[model samples]
Target: MNENFQAILLNVLPLLAIIVIAYFAMIRPQQKRNQKQNALINNLQKGDRVITVGGIHGTVKSTGAQTITLMVGRNQELTFDKLAIRDKRPS
Candidate 1:
């Protein structure tokens, strides 16, 4: 009985350590990044230059409650979901 308990503890200890490492390595940083991204999206405004995740860069032409119109080219505007925006660029 004691030997069986020892074996189980040894197996569980490694698994717990793996879980801890995974959380620190994968989950925590992702959550922090998401929070920062959300803050950026929420503060978006017209005239802010930004790039999308798809590599499209443009200046914001207008803004709605949850969308922004991006002027990608000459008179070519694209409406994107606020969440689709990636990073802001200084004008």
Candidate 2:
């Protein structure tokens, strides 16, 4: 019974350590990035230039509850979900 308990602890201890390390190394950074992305999306305003995950670049024309209108070209406005806006263009 004592040996069995030791063997189980040996196996579970490494697994638990790996889970903690993985959370700090991988999951935590990803969560921070998601929070930053959400903040960027929430702060979007008209006339801000932005790039989408699809690599589309445009200026914001308007904002809706869950969507934004971007003017990608002259006389051309495209509507996209708020999540589709990835990052604001630098200057």
On lDDT, the candidate that comes out on top is 2
Candidate 1 structure quality by residue, lDDT tens digits, 25-76: 9999999999999999988888999999899999999988888899999999
Error of 2 at 38 (Å): 0.2
* Model 2 clashing residue pairs (backbone): none
Candidate 2 regions with alpha-carbon error over 4 angstroms: 1-8
Q: Relative to the unseen true structure, what is the C-alpha lDDT of residue 10 in candidate 1, on a scale of 0 to 100?
A: 96
C-alpha lDDT values of all predictions: 0.94, 0.95
Candidate 2 residue lDDT tens string, 1-91 = 9999999999999999999999999999999999999999999988999999899999999999999999999989999999999899975
Query: Candidate 2: minimum summed lDDT over ten consecutive residues — where?
Result: 82-91
RMSD of each: 1.9, 1.7
> What TM-score does candidate 1 reach?
0.82
